[model samples]
Target: MLPEAEKLQFLKKTELFSELPETELKSICQIANEVAYPADTTLFEEGDEGDSLYLMVDGEVSIIKAGTEVLFFNEKGYCLGEIALIDNKPRSATVKTVKSTQFLRITRHDFYNAMAREPRIGSGMFRVLNDKIRRDLEIQMSAIRKEVAQEESMRLAAEVQQSLLPNQEISHPYVSSAGYCQPANSVGGDYYDYLSLPDNSIAIFLGDVMGHGYHSAMVAAMTKSCLQTQIPFDASVPEVMKAITRVIEGSRTFIYMTCCYLIIHPDNRFEFANAGHPQMLLYRGNNSEPLELESTFMPVGFARFCESEQYYSTEVEWHSGDLLVLYSDGITEACNPDAEMYGLERFKALISEKRHLSPMKIKTEILSDLRVYQQDESTTDDITLVVAKFL
Candidate 1:
């Protein structure tokens, strides 16, 4: 058994029990078991029926989904496989120890028993689970953005993809935008565009459709046509998103596009919606940490996230010198020679360090860093990034 004070302290850190009243926490500490294991120990694997969840007191864990290691957590206070205990579902990913690790563990039986004693525990857990479901869905969607081998027949597809690129420069007095796409294949599935609206506001979007070849390119082209058509009719974030959704769903193909589309006005108001894309970062001047706009819904063509086929946008103010960063999964999920991902956290830290640079200069630094980080490994997917800076 671990020290009572240490157990209580780490248990308080787990999101599962973090918000519970102290009395309840102490009650949980009674049922919690302290455990330790060496590196490479299997906590659980994908497809296993989950019986327990763990809170890391201190240690490292790798999360593997479908044979690929997707994420790792060394951050103390992070919860592990939490929904498994709550829902009793088969594990969606495999989790294993990467270092000699310690955990505060609560099995399903103990969890239910504790909840039976205090109904409030279940209530708080379910509240956290609601957020967990959304977050897990986004993580799953991002993993699906992997690259596959393209056929030699995709030469014309390459030409079509090249046609999909919008002007790489955004020229406006109050705002500046720059985008870059470095395809790993002859035909890249990434696309981005911006249009100056009749009202003088600007609509900007970046999209990544998975897979390669002609069909993917055609679907992207169709999506572009839909976007242009919709803006003239209804440029509201929801309506334009719906139009894009219709084009993709109507295609009846096995592809989906993750997108972050935003409308920024001269008055400093910007509205955007993320459809299962990676989180967009908003850096206010020179703040060390960014305000993250996380994924708001399922990917565009996976239209089930829509309530009555309508979408919603998040609004935020863009102050002078604020930088908005949008990117494809390729950039953040790139693996190094060791098969370790460069990772989203590392990417964010890089941006936070370079938030003061002009958009194009920041773009240059991102490519520079990626090259240095990737070293001997050739990336399988396209590298795409967009940065908008308000002056």
Candidate 2:
């Protein structure tokens, strides 16, 4: 049994009883029993039904969750287990004695009787519980607000990135071109553009930066600027590639991009260059098989090459209804839920199946098929595809 005077002294120091007069504290002391436990004793395990409260008088105890320490209490007059008693809920965490200790245990029935007689005891504990609940809610609300802000920022960035792309497909008397680009995220690194040359030839360029994100997007934008300003429309395919290579090499940022640039003339002859990019598919009129126009040079920004390092271009002649396909590795490397790649063979078959369609229709069909193949799976990279057909 605990001494009445000692219990009264400890109760006066606790938040729950400090507001009460000596008479009420003495009344509460009647319902509480003195309990003692050895070091390392588990007072209660998590999830156990709780029907009592513990007021620490001496020694230390720890509250643990999932084998990790949540908190520790060693000071006299500290109270615990009151939350569970008030809520009539299971214990939220395991409480173990850190050393041989003594505390006061008040059972649910006696506690309620004491509160009925002294309403101040119930009011004090309820105030503490309310404050704890409010703090937890505030923390949760702050986390939600931060997540919403991040999402909004990413949405805005996505809009800006989309604006940098061509507004629509281009149609000409000698050539009709259509292109599609999608990032694996809100912003990506794949790029495609069509330029009207001065000599009645059309330049179509498609490229992919090494990866996706702000750095890759920045590099893609830099590539666009170099292609538009540093390289001229009349420049030969090799000259165009070299000019882009030189620009990237001079930049302070070390980034590489794979690109395919093609210039189509009125005579149905197109000069094409590839910089360590995927091979271009040239389908002759009324033919199902696509001839691969392979890359003859290395990827740009790979390393500083000597002036003597040679880059070459491929020239192909075609007739009306012939189609040219240029794409990034994203399409070929797209994976299904099973981790199987949508490989080059499947891409070529899709192209062959849709070869008779218009450039815009072909672009639509290929994207539709890609979506089907990647059902419920996230795209692993930025995708870009450009289709140009001789009219």
Candidate 3:
């Protein structure tokens, strides 16, 4: 047994019992037994039922599992056996002495007696344990809240992107148009819009931004506003594209846009200008092969000169039952479970198969095929499709 003076010194070193009065410390020392064990002693094995708590006075103890030491407690005030004592369960891990060690063992009976004698001491112990538990719970709850906030932000961005899309049915007597956009994520960089001009011409735009996420979503919004300012229906496709290029090039921000603009006349003829967008697919009829109209210039905003020669124009006379499909790279780049791309061949086959279907039906079938092929893999790119058919 340690002398009262030595016991008081030891108690003072332990923060857990440091607040107790000298007399209380002496009382606790009377019931506690000092024990020494040699190196390599099995202090307690996993699955053993423990009835005593131990405080280290000297040397080290290793808490181990499956031959691996999980923790090492070498400090004078380090305590163990709390889990078994509080839960009344077997030890979950083994403890062994790394060298000759001195320790104080407090039996369950002695601990309860101390608690029963001073309810305030017991309350202090309970408060410490409860505070630690509450702190851990708060940390876990904070992580959950952060995750929820991110999802909410993404969902709101998606709704805003959807709001920017053009209405499905154009009210013009001579022209009929429909557009669809599917973002691989909650928000995407792909966008499409249609506007009716005062002179009875229709202005249509399809663009794909360089990246995805919040920045891309913001750029998409800015691009929509720029298009509104630059392209009135009276403007030819080339003029409208030039105006858009000017807006993007003038911005101080680092962003680029790949777009195609088309102006449709009431007489059933249309003119289009391309700016590094994917080829536009023209399916002449059910049995005919699709014609790909490739872009001639670099994507918009990359060059200051904005050479007009690089821009190209095309005119096509629409006939009843002819289908015009405009799409972003996302559709052709979509990968299946086997890592195969849904390339132009599959696109042609599907369009040929569904050519008799209405414009809406063709869009639905293509999207459905894309989903099934990907097997619900997360989308890596934005997808937009615009369909114009002569009825």
lDDT of each: 0.82, 0.82, 0.77
**What are the models' TM-scores?**
0.59, 0.63, 0.62
Model 2 Cα lDDT, one tens digit per residue, 1-391: 6678988988888877778899788788887789999999999988999889888899999877655555667978777788888778898778999999899999988888888888888767876677657644654565566567778977887887777788877778978888888998888988888877878888888888888897777777777777788556446777778777876787687778888888888886888888889999989876778999988767888857444347677788978888999999999999899999999999999899999999889999999998899886899899999998888
Q: Per-residue lDDT of 1-391 in model 1, one digit per residue for the tens? A: 6787877777776666767778888888887888899999999999999888787877899878777666777988667777777666899889899999998888889888887887767666876787667767766765564312223346667766777777558889778988987677776778888888998898898888876445656777887888878898899998888888877877755678898899999998999999889999899976888999999888877764345445888899989999999999899889889988889898989988988888999999988898899996998887789999998
For candidate 2, give the lDDT of residue 192: 87
Per-residue error (Å), model 3, residue 60: 34
What are the runs in model 1 whose C-alpha is more than 4 Å off?
Answer: 1-153, 304-309
Top candidate on lDDT is 2
lDDT of 3 by residue, 245-333 (tens): 76677767767888888877878778887788998877776656877777877888777655543455688776667778889999999
Q: What is the lDDT of residue 352 in candidate 2?
A: 95
Which residue pairs in model 3 clash with each other?
none
Higher-ranked by TM-score: 1 or 3: 3
